[model samples]
Structure formats: C-alpha cells, structure tokens
Target chain A: MTQPAIELDGVGKRYWKIQERSLLRSLVRFGPPNKTELWALRDANLLVEPGETIGIVGRNGAGKSTLLRLLAGVSRPTTGTVTTRGRIAPLLSVGVGFHQEMTGRENIYVNGMLLGFGKSRIDTLFDEIVEFADLADFIDTPVKFYSSGMYMRLGFSVAMHVEPDVLLVDEVLAVGDIGFRIRSLDRMREMHRSGTAVVFVSHWLQAVQLLCPRAVCMHRGQIVFDGPTEGALARHHELLTSDADSAEYARGTVRVENRQLLKLDGSPAGTVQQDSAMIYRVELHFDESVESPQVLFQVYAEDGTFVYQMQTPLGESWRTLSAGAIATLDVTFLPRFGGGGTFRNVVVVTSIDTSVTYVRDDGLAYFVEPRIGAAGLSDLEAKIAIDGVDRTESRPMRFGGTWAAVEGA
Target chain B: MNNRSLLISLAQKEFRVRYKRAWLGVIWSIALPIFQSAVMVFIFSRVGRFGSGSSFNYAAFVLAGMVPWLYLSASVASSTTSIVDASDITVKIAFPRAILPLVSPVANLFTLAISVLILFIALPIVGASVGPRFLFVLPAAVLLCAFTATLGLALGALYVYFRDVKFMVQAVLLVWIYITPIVYPPSALKGAAPWLDFNPLTGIVGLFQRAVGAPVPSVRALLVSVATTLVLGVVAIRAHHRHDRLFVDLL
Candidate 1:
C-alpha cells in the first residue's frame, strides 16, 4: 500500500481571532494573544494509501480547505501530526499566484518551481505544457492578456505534469469549459491509476460518485462519515436536512422508514421515459401521537442542479395520526419538464410548525432519461405555424434555389 | 525543482517584470539613479562644508552611497509588506515563506548591478579615480544585499503578525538616509552624536562611500553593521523556519 501516502493523527489547527492589529499590541501580547481561539480542524485523522482515490464532501467552512492546506504543507496542524510520503501538489486553486505582468511562458516556470519542479525539469516539460494548455502561439504573451480559462488551463497543465505522489484538489475544477473540465478529470484519473493518492474535494456529488470508490463526509471540522461513497453521500444529505434533535423526533414522534420513486405501474424506476407518470412514496410510522405533519419533496438533476420542489401547505391541518399507526403517502406526477439526465427524489417529513424535521430519506436515485432526440432541460416540443401553415421546416421549399433566398435563409 | 531553482525563478519574474513594461526598458533602472546622483553631486559640491570636504569628489560619493541606500529603502519597504501582500497566494499553496521577502531583494539585485556599472562609468567623469579600491565594491555589494534581505526577512515575518510594521518601516526609512551620512560623510556626525556610529546603515553607507574614496568608514560603524546584520538575519531565518507552515493560518 506504499505506507500511507498521507496520514493525519489527531490533527488540529488553532487560529486566533485578533481584535486589533498593531505593532505595539503584538510585541506585548504575552497575555494569551488578546483573542479567542478558532479550531478550524480538531482531532481529525485520515490515512490514504498510494493509488487510492477518496472524495471529501462538506458544506462551506466545514474545514475542508483547512484540511487540504494541512495536507499540502501550506499550514501546520496546531495540535497533532500530518505526514505525507512524497511530493505533494496542491491544486487548491486555479492557477493561484500567477503574476499578471509575466508571460504565460514565464509564469509556468515560476509555478512549476513552486510545485517542486526544477528549471531543467520544467524545460523538458515545457513543450508539453504549452501544448496541453493549447497556448502554443500565445505562451510568450503576458498572462494579463489571457482569458481566465487560458489561465486555468495553463495552471492545471503545470500542476498535473508534476507527477506528485499526493494530489490535493479543492473545488478548482468547477471552472473553464466542459471539454477542458472533462480532460482535467481524465488526467487526474490517469494519475490516480499510476499510484498517486488523490484527495478530491468538491460539492458536486455526481463528481464524487464518478471518481471515488470511498468518500468522507466532513461536518463542523470532523469526519462525520467515512465508507462507501453512496453511504457517505446519504449521510451528508441526512446532515443537511435535519437538526440536532433529528433522532429524537425521528424515532419517537414520526419516523420515515423508507422512500421510493417508482413508475406508476409500481416497478422500480431509476430512469423512466420523459412525460411518464411516476409515484414518489414515503412510508412512515408514528411512535407517539402527532397531528398534521408537513411532507416535502425535492427533485434534482444528475449534476446537482435543482429541478423541482413541493411542500404540503401549512395546513395538512385536517390530517392527524395516532401512536402505532403506519401510513404510506404517494406523490404522483408526470414530469412534464426537467428531463434529460439522471435525477433523484428527496422526501422530508417535518413538524407542522416547521420547528423540527422528523426524517429525510434522500437516496432515491431517479432518472428522467433523455427522450431519444430530446435535448436541454425538457422536451418542449414546438412546431411553428405561420398563417395556419406548419412552416417550421418549409425554408428549403419556400426559398428553393433563388439567390436572394439563400441570403435570407 | 530544488529550493534554489524556485528562488531563482521567483527572482527572475521580479527582475523581468520591473523593466519589461517600461518604454526605456532596463535603461530607466540605470538612468533614474544617475539623475538623482547628478543633482546631489551638484548641490553637495557647492555646499562642501556640510559634506565631507572640498578635497573629496562629492559626486562619486553620492552615487556609491545612493545606489545601496536606494536599493535598501525600496527593498525593505517592499519586504515589509511582501508576506502580507502575498497572503492570497500563501494561503492557497505552501512554499517556503522566507523566500517571499527575499524575492524583492534578489530581484532588486539585477537593477542594483546595472546601477553599479553606471556608478563605475560615472566615477572617473566626476573626478574620482578608478583604482585597486574598486574591487571592494564586490564584497560591499554582497554585504548590502545580505543586510537588506535579512532586515527585510525579519520585517516581513513581523509584518504578517503586526500590520503596523509596514508603515513603521516607511516612516523609519524616510529619516534613515539623512542620519546614515549618505550625502555627507561620517565625519559630519563627529561632535553631534558619536553614537551615530552604532547605527547599522552607518557602516553600510560608509563602505559604499569608501569604495568611491569619499571617506574612511569608522571601525565601530562596521562592527555595528555586522552585529545588527547577524542579529536580524537570525531573527528572519528562524521566524520563517518556524512559521512557514503556520503563516497560512493567520492569513
């Protein structure tokens, strides 16, 4: 396993929230820093073997950046130890630290050196880098004249070419055009296949699913779940939907045990034909008597793009439940729009007053397959009619071979 | 690559960027100091009693002193803020933090070398002789760069923690030149404050002035400069070694 390419043991990082910044105050700051301590990360532990790819998913400020920084050796852990075996390259940001006035050619050398490559090494890799970034003619031009995508491309190329043993990528892949984005991911996969330990951090769950066999979910500076990618993601969603008292109400008041997105025919359906009716069912049991619970459903496309959401009104008021009662609620809808890709259904059962959520069963992966020739978010079939004549495809016939018609067409 | 190459690349970027955008190219880096020295020589020559003496070619004296002093002031000012200024880069990626402040001094060395070439070419024209003493500028230049880097390193590291250091360095550099006997000579401070010899820049400026045969630098001043350089150099290198990985936290 190559002795854990990266390992963290009881790692913690403490930062001071200084109230004031002055030379005089700092010189005499012997009395406890005149500030409060913020532990961005605490007692965190991780071990990544060579050739392993792991995904880290977390909300903003969940210490993800802090964790990457420590692993990159950019920041030292305040309490414990962080150790790595080989050259560590941080794709923490896209082309970070690029000097604006320097040429693309020059910035590459500078950035490469910072990533632990020598001038000769960079020189050898120079042609490949320039070609990879697709900036052959413009490599000598100062980067200030380059577009943001060019900058990102050049940066990604240099970092990838370094062949580091440990790669820490943090949310920087979300930019540039889709073609380059896919290429970058492919290059990362190539590196991973060659024995580099990859720590991938992104909010895109689909990306996690595509890249990682195992994923770690972080919350409030600690690893909340670490196991199969699906389980970690499910736990992350559970964290997102419920508060601290979730378990209390989830088990005692009303508990949603299972949920499913099924075709109206009652067969399991992950990918169904567009415009077909499907049923989202949430099966729950009441441990204690409760009245008028609100149920919510949300649908999101494969890319984590929000699709549609619905909630029972403030009054499902007439509805009531007693202890030991079990019920199944079905939401049937024809997904007329929001098609073209895999989707998922999330069901949340909350208290009537909206104070607490009892359960959120979110791992129902559903797919609204792209209808054969359909494209975009939905299949909005449009047939243009002019003067009561269907002329959407009449351009060639109406214009025929007329010279003036060619320009108009 | 090794740290040495990284340092070289960083310095190369700094050197190239400074002169690349100007219409005059690197010529401006050489010309601006000569212009300043020309004016200082003209004024100092007329007011000989305030300078070293009528016997000395004050023009050569000012050029030698001005080159290092100008480099020091600019380098130190930039170093004071280098760490804080690069917080964005520092926070995102990890590298040796000490190198950030050192980059400015190393970059300035390119311009300083060009200015020194101009200084030698201008010396004979200003009635100063080119003799065996000219070789001394080699050691003196090294000393000047080393001193600036160390002072800057210490200041840059401190600046990250104490935001006031940047302004304080500027305020000090403003009054520092006049007190260091750059335009005049060390003899000018004989009666007013002999302890002025203890100021580190006193010996540094004294060395450059001596390179042009302006005045003999006092032993105390040289000792003080070396002493201060050692102390500050230690502080700078040690701070970076201990805090290089931790600086990102504060940033």
Candidate 2:
C-alpha cells in the first residue's frame, strides 16, 4: 500500500457561539455584556492510508459534516493537529465555487487552480476535464445556464482530473440522477484503485456500503463505531433498534408499550437472518376504550423510501379496550428484501379509521445484508423462459414492475 | 507541463468570454468612459460651472479623473463580493481563496486599458498638448490599480463575514466621486483644502490632473496617497492569507 496520505492525531474543532451578533448597538448594550461558549467536535481522532476509501456515516447533527470540513481544510481545528501529504481535492456538495457569469471552460481553469494546480498543468489536463464533463458544446457558455446535472458533471470532472492524492467527498453524489451517480461513483472507485486516499460522508448506508470497505459511524459528536463497513453498519443498526431508551415512544389509540422481534420458539431474536421467517411481537398498552384497532407496520429501505407495509385484519370488532389493559400483537413475514443495506421497521397502532394513531414508533431501523450479488428490495423466486430455455435469475427482485403470461381476452 | 498552464489559460478564458456578447465587442470598454467624457466636456464647456482655468482643458480634466475613478469603483465593488458570488465553486472544490478576488481586478484591467487609450484620443481634441509628461499617468495608473485591488481583496474578505459590507460599499461609492474632485477642480475647496490632502483619493486625482498640466498637488498629499495604497495593500494581503481557506465556511 502507498504511504499514509492523510493523518489526524487527536484533532478537534471548536466553534464559538456569540451570545449576540457584534453589531454596533449590541456591542454597546448595557455594561458590555453577553456570553459565549465552545460547542461541537472535541478530541476526535483518525488516520487514513493512501488508496484507502473510508466512509463516514452518522445521524443529523452528529458532527459528520464537521469532520468532513476539517478534512477538506474548509476550517481549521481549534485544537490538535492535521497533516496531509499531497494535493487534496474535495468534491463537496454539488457544484461549489462556480461563478454564474463564467463559462464552463473558464470555471474549469479557475477551479483547477483553486485545487492547487499551476496554470501550465491545468492547460494540459483541460481537454480531459472537459471531455469527462461531457460539455464540449456548452464549455463556452456561462455556467448559470448549465443545468444542475451539467454543473455537477463539470465540478466532478475538474476535481478528478486534478489527480489529487487525497479526495474528500461529502454527500454530493446524492443530488445526481442514477446514470450520473453511477459514473461519479465509477470515477471515485477508479481514484481509489489508483492510490488516492478517499474520505466520503453520507447518510445513505447503502452508498457507504457500496463505495467504502472500511467505515466509521458517528453519533453526537463521538465516533460510535469504526471498523469494517459491514460491522459498522451492523452496529449502527443495533444502536437504532435496541430501544432500551427511545424518546420517540409510540402514541396512538393503543400505545405500543413494548415491542420485540422473536424466533419461532418464543425466544427473542434481536437479529434475524436475511432469508429466515421471523416474528415481530408488539405489546400495546391502552388508555381509553376502542372498537377496532388496525395495527400497521412498515419496513423502509436504506434511503428511507418505503419498502412495504402490512396491516392486521381490518374488520375484526373488539370490545371496548379499557384503560390499563395490555394487549399483545404479533406479525410474521419471511425476510426477503434483497439489497444488503440497513432497513428500518416502524410500528403504528391506530383506530379502525387508520387516521388517528395512538401509538407510533419510527425509530427501529434494521440492517439486512443480503447474500453477495443480490440486488433490490426482495428475493422472490422466479424464472424467465425464452425459446423453451429457462433462465434462472440469480439477482434479487427490486421494488416495482412484474412480468406474467396471460391468456387472450 | 500540465500544471503551470492553468493560470494563463484561465485568465485568457475569462478575458475572452467577457466581451464575447457585446455589440462593439472589446470597444465597449473604451466606449463607456469616452462617452461619459464627451457628456462631461459638453456640460462643463457650456455651463462653465467647474471653475475652469487657462492651464488645463476642463474636458481633459474630467476624462483623467473618470479613468481612475471608474477603475477604482468598478474593481472595489466587484471584488468585495467576488468570493461570495462565486460560491457555487468555492464551497465544493478546494482552491486558493485569492483567485476569486484576483479575477475581478484582472478582468477590469481591460476596461482600465481602454479608458487610458480614450484618454489620449480625447487629449488633442480638448486643446491639450501631449508630451513625455503623458508617461506620468502610467505610474499613477499602476498605483491606482494597486490600491483598488488592495481594497477589493480586503473588502471581499470582510463581505463574506459581514453581508452588510456590500451595501456600505455602494453607499460610500455614491458619495465618493464628489469628494474626489472628479467633476470639479481641487482649488474650489478653498478653505477646506488642507483637509482634502488627507483624503487618499485626492492624491490620485491630483496625479491624473498633473499629467494634463493642471495645478499639481502638494508633496505631502501625494506622499499620503502612496503610503495609504501601500498600507491598504499590505493589510488586505495579510487578512486574505489568514482567512483564505476559512472564507468558504462563512459563505
């Protein structure tokens, strides 16, 4: 492996919170007064070897952005030290630093220089950057007119062509379309293969899993887990679902006082296999009386898009569930979602109308790392036949669309 | 081979694209101040309100002042907001923060050059004799540009943190021309002449007027202008060096 391209030893950043803006009036306010203190990022540490692609995953306000900003040199750490070996390029949030009045060609030069290239070097690489952006015709036009996709294309092209020793990517790939995203990821992968130390920050666990073999998970300005991508993801899921203490208590006509995933023999199965049938047992504590309660549960894909939802029998009438009555509900489904990423399970207890929910829990996110080469949301068994030859499909079934044989009407 | 060429290629690219859409093409740079000079010449000649003296043509007087004033105002106004305005690229990519401020002054050089050319063309028409004294405007132009960029870089950095700086700059520029002796002669100040020496712009305008053989400024005022330019330039560079990479965070 190449030498360590980026190193941080006990590096931490502290920001001041001004009690009030230092405006003329505010500064002269009664007796020179206001308070300020340090917040966010203290005593953080990490080291990255050259050619290593590392993913950083965390919830909102987790200081993930703070860490990325430090890596990019956007802001310096208030304490500790950061040392980098060579030219560093940051592909931050989409199309940063582009001047609206400037054309694509002009921006590329300006951008290339900003990334630490001298003028002559940029001239030689100019064509490559332009070609990568696919903006041959629009290169001379003002970037204000370029669509978001074009802008991103140009930005990434310039960054990649700079041949940076260390590349910092911050959730910018989330904005592009699928094709562009694929290309950008391919370029990033190529960079990794060519010995560029990479640090990528994203909320998408799937994206993290796809690009980074090694990953770290952050929570509340602290590194919760740091290891292999798969292990980090598993720990992240455990943190999300091990609701020993969750503030988001279920609220509905019947409040879910407790919920647990269990094995077939009535033992709690905290983690389930990707292909095994499992039972999700929930206990609802009722406050007021109700006629019928429709308990709903949903599983979400890594990107937070809904995977599927199920409801209990709708028409079953129940006697008034008085206050202080504890009822148990169980749901069993074969774990079939195909893609190997984190999936969140949410349970909501509602009235028969399904409009006024008494208990709702959206915090329990689960991780499902499907077998290798599998894809999409589900693993439904199916076969394709062409000219009497059956094509046994190996990939998992992605969400949406289906094929079938139908007799003539 | 590829690395050193980026700066030259970018500067050329920016210069070419700036005038790509104009009707008169690159001539628009010269045309703007020349037209303004024509209007000033007509108004002052007919009205005789600018305290004209026999030594210098009022037409040439106004053109000289307009040249530096245009360069200073345009450079400062644009440079103050250059980084913030180019936020699209600054926030995403890693680059030297100085490039944003650098682009404006570099681009404005074209117009500054045009104004100087027009200054010469207007000189003979306005009854002024041209001589080696014309070379004096070169140093004066250089000094003026140096100061303008210094102010631009400094103000641009402040602008990233304090958004109100842009409006404050506009407000100052609105009142700046009157104080600079651009439209009228410095002698008109009379009793207030001593205080006028303290104003940095007075020396610059005095230098331009001197090139045209107008009443040359006192030595102290000229020294003050040169000193202010050097001081402001130093301050701007120091501030930018310290805050260059961090500017994007505030932006």
Candidate 3:
C-alpha cells in the first residue's frame, strides 16, 4: 500500500494564447484581450510506483514537455491534480539558472541549491559531480567558455548527484559525447536500480526501448496509448505515418496506398528474424501520365537513423504509366540490422530523373530480432574471445531484451 | 528553511556575478553613490541654493537621501523583471517565484550597506555630528528594503503578464526621485510641503534626514510609508502564491 512515486489524476494544462498585451489597449478596451485557449495536456491520469522507469514517446507539440513540466511542478495544471512524492529532480536541457559569467564551481553550488540541495550537501557531493562531468580541468573556468556538451554534462552530473526520489528527464540524454552518453545511461540504470521513479521523455525510441519496460504514447495533447514500450512505439509510428499521409495528400500527385511488410510467404511480418528476407508491398495510384517511374527504398532505425537506401538505376525504363493508372510495387530485402530493433521502411516513387517525388510512403514499420549476442545498427556478427576462450553468448541477445541482460551478454 | 537557503544562495550568486567581470568590483557599490551625492551637493549648494537656509550639513543630507534612493531605484528596476529574466530556470524548475524578485533587493544590500557607511563617514566631515537619533537609520534601512522588495515582487509578477510594466517602472523612477524630497527639503516646497507627505518615500527619506539633525517629517508621512509597504507586501505574497506555478506558462 505504499504511495505511488508520481500520480496524475485527470490532469490538464491550458495556456491562453494572447494576441497582444498592451497597457493602453487593455485600459482602453472594456473587455479582456483576444485570446485562445490551448490545452497542452488534457485528461492525463497516470501512476508510477517507486523504482519504475517509464518512457514517453510522441511527435513534436504532442504534450510530452507539458507533462514533464507538470511532473516537475514547474507549472500547475489548469484542471485535475498532479502529485509527486519526495524530491523531484528535472534534468532539463543544459543548465538552468546558469550565469554565463559564473565559473563552473560557482554554478554547481547555485544550480544545486536551485534544485533544493543545501550548501553543506553540495559541498559533500561537489567532487563527485565534477568527476562525473569530467570537467575537473574546467571547474574553475566560467561556464560561458564551456562548450555546449560540457554545459550539458555539468547539468546532468548535478541532477544525478541529487539522488532524487522522482526524476523527470526531457531530451537531455541526446547530448554529450558518446562516452558521456554511455555513462549517463549507466548512471540512470543505477538510479533505476536504487528504487527511484523515472519519467523519461525522448524522441530516441531506441533508448526508450532499452531503458523503459512501459511507456505512454501521446498525440495532440492526449494519451493515445499507454502500455508496453513496443506497443507505444507502434502507436507513435502509426500517428507519424498518418500525419505524413495527409501532408502528401495536400501535394496532390501520385498516392501510395495499401503498404504492407510481408514475409516471403506473403503473410504479415510481425517480427522478422535477423537476416530474414521480407517484401515491402504497396500500390501506387497516379493522377497523371508519367514516364518510367523510379522507386527509392529506404530503411530507418527506430531512432530515425537512415540505415539503408536503394534507388532504381538511372536510364532504366521499367514501364510508362498512363493517367489514373494503378501499379503494384514489391521490394524484397534481408533485414541485416544488428542488435535488432524496430525499423521503418519507406518507399518513394519519383520521376525517372529522380527530380520529382510523386509520393513518399512511410507506412511499413517492423521489428527485427537481432542475432545472438549481437547489438547495434548493423549485425556484423561480431564474435568475442577472452584469453583463448570464446566468450560470446551462443544465443545472441535480441532487441527488446532486458537492459541488464543486454549489458551482461 | 530550504527555500530560505535557496533565496540566500540566489542572492549571493546575483551579487557575485554582477561584480565578477567589473574591474572595480564591489568598490563600485560604494563609489557610485558617493559620486552621485557629490554631484548633487555641488549643484544644489551653488546652482539652486536650496540647502543654504537649511540648519543641517547639506552634503550629509543629500548622501543620506541618496543611499535609500539608489537602493530603491536599482532594486526595483531589476526585481521588476526578475522573473522574466530568469525564464530559463522558471520554466524548468519549481521554487517560490517570489524569491526571484526579492533577490535583487537582497543582492543590492551590499551596496546599500556600503552607501550607508559612506554616509555615516561623510556626516562628520561635513560638520554634521552623529547623534543617537542616527539610531533611526536602522529601522529606516529595514523599511526601505521591505518596501523595495514588496514592490519588486508585485511588479515582477505583473511584468510576466504585461511587458509594459518594465518601461512603466523605468518612466516612474525617472520622475520619482524629484518628488520624493531627495534633492530638495520638503520646506523648500513651502505650502506644498504637506502635499509631499503623500509620497511614501517622504517618511523613509525623512528618517535619514532626521538622523543628520534635519527637522522630522510629519507623522502622517511615516504612517503612509508603513501602510504602503504593508499593503504591497500582502499583494505581493498573494500574487506569488496564486501565480508561482502558473508563471511558467507565460514564460
């Protein structure tokens, strides 16, 4: 019967979009200023137990930041209630309240206090923060001179040392060098293991999948889906593709329809195994007559990294399509993604010279199971030997495995 | 208690950062008021002759008035925009937004203290002896700070909603010094001296002048100053309590 670390009960935040704020105009006019209410978040109800790590996935303007702000207690919800227990540390972007002229050592004390840490507590944790940030050399230098990466590292380092009961992170994981990024992830994992509740918001779905067992997907200021990370990401992609469809429709040209990722036997591919061949099938409806149309196939990792791309060779004539013609296209390829994760397959139909893109379809999103013990974008099938003993796990670790198992294997 | 420490640390940061790059550092805190006081003494003693008929040392009187005036002007100007200037932190972290506007006044305390010290030292050199009445300076300083802080807090909240408050504050400060009996004694206004009592600063500044042996201001003026501070303090506290979390929305 322990209290949830964080709770949101029918919470909503509304912002008034005021057209203009002028003293004279307000005094002269009898009524209030012209304004529209924008609900950044609405009817959100959530409960997170201690030690739970939950991810939030959504497109831009989807209320992720609004939810984080609420959880951090930075803004009050216009309706309902948001309750968080114990100390809440928000690792927002870069340094908050960091004065440019202040040295790193000074900023640490100031920033730490702003996070509700006392002076004596900061004194005890100062060295650890500096060491973690790897800014021992620049600790005395003003922050204005530090690089953006250095600034972010310092900010992140301080928040981690706070040992907060509830941690709300917003897009801060994407900064810093690769080494720091890995160290941060490790620090977050350590915090997770220590029973801190974490609410992580990120567009980096791969990181989300690696860290969070559960996730909430948001769209248009509402929670569209809340469940496992896999299902949330699937829902997110559906919204993204649907949004793309409307944008394409506005262009008024060839329309890509009925896109599907199917196994060799033509059944819908739920989860394709590593190196397994699959076919991306789609139909193209042309509004006007066109010469030999070119096809471009692209694959993107869940984090939006462009994995691979192929296009029709120049000067190759497949066939001409007349007005109102319907053509079926099938692209076959082996999913060679390493450390398998969810991926998106996009198909673009363009003119022969590749100058005019008639339609771009991003409908087919599928998961690839990585080879045993394999991780990363491409499965190079890397093997390991330690002191003349084979150390690689025979059963390769697949995508969506537990974080600890992935690290241990 | 935690928030108290936060306020102190933020004020410390503001104090340190302001002088970090300045070549003169904190000396400017003492020097700026002395320089301004000297200029006023020169102009009024010769050009206007307003202090010729006064019984007290005009230099000390001007310096006394300058101490509170400078603190009020600087603190109010900065505190009025404190919340908006700190949008970076306000939009992310949660804390008492009142601390933001209060920091400027608290941070300027160093300067206020330095200016007051300079005034005490100049009093004897200008033939104005330090009397036990100078004890009034203590309560005077406290009231001055309270008034500035409360005003700053209320205006800081207002500025978040209407940016015009910044310019309005600046415009008011420009005309405020003249009407506050800072440069000229209330007696200089003759029959209009009673009207000057309506200005809240008349009572606070009169305390400083009284410390230097000038005639005490009307009792009504002191009440006016106290009442204004109390009212502004209540308005400020209420505004912050209601809008502390909501300020981030506008930010």
Fraction of true contacts retained by every candidate, in order, equals: 0.81, 0.49, 0.86
Cα lDDT tens digits, model 1, A1-409, are 2499988999998878888978788677676777888888989988888988888987678888889988888888889899998898888777778999999999898888888788889999999988888899899899999998998999888889999999888777878887888678778878987889989898755556556778898988888888876667766655654432244435546776656667888995544556779887777788877788888888777577787888989655767788888989898977754225456677777888877877776546643434433345655776668999876532221111232246477
Query: Is model 2 an incorrect, acceptable, medium or high docking prediction?
Result: acceptable
lDDT of each: 0.78, 0.75, 0.86
> Could you report the DockQ of all the candidates, in the order they appear?
0.64, 0.41, 0.84
Which 10 residues in a row give candidate 1 chain A its minimum summed lDDT?
A394-403
Instruction: Please name the candidate that would achieve the greatest DockQ relative to the true structure.
Output: 3
Off by over 4 Å in 2: A1-3, A18-38, A100-103, A135-147, A174-186, A239-253, A261-273, A302-304, A318-320, A352-356, A370-374, A381-409, B1-25, B45-48
Task: Say which candidate scores most in TM-score.
Answer: 3
Per-residue alpha-carbon lDDT of model 3 for A72-114, expressed as tens digits? 9999999999999998999988786688988999999988988
CAPRI-style quality class for the chain A–B interface of candidate 3: high
Q: After superposition, how far is residue B87 of candidate 2 from its true place, in Å?
A: 2.7
lDDT by residue for model 3 over B1-251, one digit each (tens)?
87888888788889988887899998887778888889988898788788886888787888788889999998999999999999999988888898899999999998888887888888888888998988888989998998998999999999998899999999999999999988888889989899988899999999988888888878999999999999999998998999999999988
Superposed on all Cα atoms, the candidates' RMSDs to the truth, in angstroms, are: 10.2, 6.2, 2.9
Residues A1-409 of candidate 2: C-alpha lDDT, one tens digit per residue: 5567877777776665555443464536886456555546767778788888888887777788778777777677777787888888988877766767788987887777778777678889999888877899999889999999999889988988889989888878777677777677678767777888888888766667666777887766777788877777766667666643465564444666566776788886644567677787777788777768777789877677898899877657765677778888787877787655667677777777766777667645666655434567886644568888976554322111110111111
